[model samples]
Target: MNLIKRLAGLLAVAASCSAVAAPLLSEGFNDVAALPADGWAFINNSSPPGSTGWFQGNPAFFAAADGPAGSYVAANFNNAAFGGAVSNWLLTPELLLVNGESLNFSLRLLGEGLLDRVEVYVSSAGASTNVGADFSLLAAFESPAGTGWLDRRLALSGLAAPASGRYAFRYVVDDTSLNGNYVGIDSVSVNAIPEPGTVALVFLGALALVAPRRLRQSRGLWLLAGGLAAGTAAAQAGPDGLMRFPHVQVVSQPAAPAAPGPGGFMAYKDPVTGQLTGPNPEQAALLTAAARAPTPLLRQTPPAPRPAHGGISLMLDERQARYAVVRKAPDGSVHESCEPAPGGLK
Candidate 1:
């Protein structure tokens, strides 16, 4: 019996070992200065009056870095000298990558003044097709507000094209304002996501550990079966179940109650009984009545208030044109004191 218990424990351990692991695809762009001649291309999309793409006339801008990590391009869009609008550049290939699964990369916009946006596109291959024109936009990322450089990440899971063959990924800068904007993209890799068949192996490994044992005659075989059963049982019991072998009972700890405290000028209490009181309501009301009551009419003048430009717009969509008002914070920061606003995107 003791031997069987040990076998069951082993089985449970095996089950846990089976699980899908996210992996890297392919990477590029460490040397933006010398872009690969064949597989890549870029073009500027700046407005007529503004500078298109980077100053050197290419869509991507190059820069020098500090380590064996070598150097890479600093993806900047804001050209202050040109009305803060820079080129909306794109990089693509002639072939369609239908089965392409993941596009993994890193971005750092090391300052508060910087704002960055990344857009991805996909399309099926066709003769005489303008690959860029036929491409369908997939994912777009906008940098969050802050001072120090931010390490940004995005997982390309649902962005795969429906058909196989020719496919491409494009990066664009949609912002046209110069606020010390600078961005760095590296380890730019694209690889296929794991096939369903590969994922099955992970599950099978886990199953082997926790499954029931067979009653085959050989003692070794029985022991192997028992270990798997035990492992399976242990996992099903959850973390607290580990104690089951020792005949221990589990107990849950209860949470403590909240303490009372004063808030704002108004006193608060349980709505059932108005036991809470702070300011004298009667006295305050009498004072207000006296002040408001009509008196020998006195002339009065009103002063003007300062102007402010603070409003939020949530533009959530593909074309990236129209915007919906998801949250309105007249005071700036989001107002969630009430029920939470629906999904936050703009």
Candidate 2:
């Protein structure tokens, strides 16, 4: 009975641990030179054109006044050389947002420029490029000049959550007066919110762990708790009944060709098309023999233009283009044709 209670306690703990949601996306701009890569895009929409748009790695653009000495993406309109009006956008990669997910990032502002405004937009219909057409504003604010770095967190539940497709964050800055003040952003992240059901299950599991020993001893209670735990565990397993971890899979290179066959020819099967290619004399002889067999001959469609050297060429027949083979005759006349090329062709 004590062992049973311990087992239940362990199960409850495991259930609770597994209920925590994982981060969907995280990015920290430690290397300014590597910016705008890995799906991050920057666009300049300023009209009358000479505005110096967003710039990264500028020593002036730091996340915090006295914090880490690293780079952050920044936009400034105050000292614009091509000054008339400035509109710039920094976009994040497509991100998947669920009902209870949230977005967070760190921002820093410098100078007393009140004319500059920063707005954050989100889109589900398409890329968050257009302001009024595709993306809807999520939040907007004027950077309070001299405010060092500030952490911002926004709840995304029920906001532009689509069944499929992507969500992009469009950060826009507009300065009609060329205030020259700077707005910097860093350490952006998106995280999922654990579902209520998961929380309830975790709570129930915890409660089961603290139940009176007498209650734990009851066979019915044990069966009920065990069944629930099993169901939860099964739900988390992949289709093949194995636990699934979210991680990138590395594709391995193709395997080397098979050893030479008895006829000194090597064969390899295409992983994608499932077609087999071989230089085996035995297989070639068999194909040649089969071509000479007394099978009824049918008219073959003219072959398509030959491909460039080392390129794939398809040969079609009246019925269909099933296979392609290059045949060499006793007289050294080489012919390429579709599968089962008419039994005899001089």
Superposed on all Cα atoms, the candidates' RMSDs to the truth, in angstroms, are 23.9, 24.0
TM-score of 1: 0.39
lDDT of every model, 2 decimals: 0.40, 0.53
Q: For each candidate, what TM-score against the reference?
A: 0.39, 0.51
Candidate 1, 112-142: lDDT as tens digits: 5454444444445442234335554444444
Q: Judged by TM-score, which candidate is best?
A: 2
| Tens digit per residue, CA lDDT, model 2, 74-162 | 77763244444555667677776556556777766564644344556555654444433555455544543555666766556454433
Name the 10 consecutive residues with the lowest summed lDDT in model 2.
Answer: 257-266
Displacement of residue 284 (Cα, Å) in model 1 is 54
After aligning candidate 1 to the native by TM-score, how far in Å is the CA of 98 from where it should be?
A: 5.8
